[model samples]
Target: MHTELDFAFRRDGETVRSGGLVYATVSAEGRAAIALPARLVEMLGEVRSIRPSR
Candidate 1:
Protein backbone atom coordinates (compact mmCIF):
# COMPACT_ATOMS: atom_id res chain seq x y z
CA MET A 1 0.00 0.00 0.00
CA HIS A 2 0.95 3.62 -0.56
CA THR A 3 0.27 6.67 1.60
CA GLU A 4 0.78 10.43 1.39
CA LEU A 5 2.54 12.36 4.13
CA ASP A 6 2.74 16.07 4.91
CA PHE A 7 5.08 18.20 7.06
CA ALA A 8 4.84 21.69 8.58
CA PHE A 9 7.11 23.54 10.97
CA ARG A 10 6.33 26.25 13.56
CA ARG A 11 9.18 28.19 15.09
CA ASP A 12 9.39 29.43 18.66
CA GLY A 13 8.56 33.01 19.72
CA GLU A 14 6.77 33.44 16.40
CA THR A 15 3.22 32.87 15.30
CA VAL A 16 2.77 29.31 14.03
CA ARG A 17 1.96 29.74 10.38
CA SER A 18 0.82 26.92 8.18
CA GLY A 19 3.84 25.85 6.17
CA GLY A 20 1.53 24.19 3.67
CA LEU A 21 1.42 20.65 2.32
CA VAL A 22 4.65 18.80 1.49
CA TYR A 23 5.24 15.72 -0.67
CA ALA A 24 7.11 12.92 1.12
CA THR A 25 8.00 9.35 0.31
CA VAL A 26 6.75 6.77 2.80
CA SER A 27 8.88 3.71 3.53
CA ALA A 28 9.65 1.22 6.29
CA GLU A 29 12.19 3.63 7.73
CA GLY A 30 9.43 6.29 7.66
CA ARG A 31 8.70 9.25 5.42
CA ALA A 32 11.46 11.26 3.81
CA ALA A 33 11.47 14.97 3.09
CA ILE A 34 11.00 15.36 -0.65
CA ALA A 35 9.87 18.98 -0.72
CA LEU A 36 9.02 21.50 1.99
CA PRO A 37 9.04 25.18 2.86
CA ALA A 38 12.41 26.78 3.47
CA ARG A 39 10.99 28.45 6.57
CA LEU A 40 10.82 25.14 8.42
CA VAL A 41 13.74 26.09 10.65
CA GLU A 42 11.97 29.30 11.66
CA MET A 43 9.01 27.37 12.99
CA LEU A 44 10.71 24.34 14.43
CA GLY A 45 9.31 24.93 17.90
CA GLU A 46 5.79 25.86 16.90
CA VAL A 47 5.17 22.72 14.92
CA ARG A 48 1.66 21.77 15.91
CA SER A 49 1.41 18.47 14.05
CA ILE A 50 2.39 16.60 10.91
CA ARG A 51 -0.97 15.75 9.44
CA PRO A 52 -0.95 12.84 7.00
CA SER A 53 -3.36 12.39 4.11
CA ARG A 54 -6.04 9.90 4.95
Candidate 2:
Protein backbone atom coordinates (compact mmCIF):
# COMPACT_ATOMS: atom_id res chain seq x y z
CA MET A 1 0.00 0.00 0.00
CA HIS A 2 1.22 3.47 -0.90
CA THR A 3 0.16 6.87 0.37
CA GLU A 4 0.96 10.34 -0.89
CA LEU A 5 1.75 12.52 2.10
CA ASP A 6 1.06 16.22 2.30
CA PHE A 7 3.67 17.47 4.73
CA ALA A 8 3.47 20.48 7.05
CA PHE A 9 5.91 22.00 9.53
CA ARG A 10 5.37 21.31 13.23
CA ARG A 11 7.67 23.06 15.73
CA ASP A 12 7.41 22.89 19.51
CA GLY A 13 3.74 21.85 18.99
CA GLU A 14 2.57 24.41 16.42
CA THR A 15 2.28 24.49 12.68
CA VAL A 16 4.69 26.98 11.19
CA ARG A 17 4.79 27.96 7.56
CA SER A 18 7.64 26.01 5.94
CA GLY A 19 7.56 26.23 2.19
CA GLY A 20 9.16 28.00 -0.70
CA LEU A 21 7.77 31.50 -1.15
CA VAL A 22 7.09 32.76 -4.63
CA TYR A 23 7.93 36.44 -4.95
CA ALA A 24 5.34 38.61 -6.65
CA THR A 25 6.10 39.96 -10.07
CA VAL A 26 5.95 43.74 -9.80
CA SER A 27 3.51 45.83 -11.87
CA ALA A 28 6.62 47.65 -13.04
CA GLU A 29 7.55 44.22 -14.32
CA GLY A 30 3.98 43.89 -15.75
CA ARG A 31 2.24 42.08 -12.86
CA ALA A 32 0.85 42.54 -9.33
CA ALA A 33 1.04 40.83 -5.98
CA ILE A 34 -2.03 39.05 -4.60
CA ALA A 35 -3.38 39.85 -1.13
CA LEU A 36 -4.29 36.86 1.00
CA PRO A 37 -6.31 36.89 4.21
CA ALA A 38 -4.38 35.95 7.34
CA ARG A 39 -5.21 32.67 9.03
CA LEU A 40 -4.35 30.88 12.29
CA VAL A 41 -1.95 27.95 11.96
CA GLU A 42 -1.98 25.11 14.45
CA MET A 43 -1.19 21.39 14.54
CA LEU A 44 -3.26 19.38 16.98
CA GLY A 45 -2.13 15.91 16.06
CA GLU A 46 -4.15 13.62 13.76
CA VAL A 47 -7.87 13.07 13.37
CA ARG A 48 -9.10 9.61 14.26
CA SER A 49 -12.33 10.08 12.29
CA ILE A 50 -10.63 10.63 8.98
CA ARG A 51 -10.34 8.02 6.24
CA PRO A 52 -8.55 7.57 2.94
CA SER A 53 -10.31 8.51 -0.28
CA ARG A 54 -11.84 5.71 -2.32
lDDT per residue for candidate 1 within 1-54, as digits (tens), equals 222334445688554654454433345566653344445434444545555433
Best by lDDT: 1
Residue clash pairs of candidate 2: none
Off by over 4 Å in 1: 13-49, 52-54
Give Cα-based local distance difference scores for all models. Answer: 0.45, 0.37
Candidate 2: list runs displaced more than 4 Å.
1-4, 18-54
RMSD of candidates 1 onward, in order:
10.4, 14.5
The local distance difference test score of model 1 is: 0.45
Q: Which lDDT value does model 1 have at 42?
A: 46
For model 2, how does the per-residue alpha-carbon lDDT over 1-54 read when each residue is reduced to its tens digit? 112224457799886754332222233454554432122112323423222454
Shift of residue 6 alpha carbon in model 1, Å: 1.6
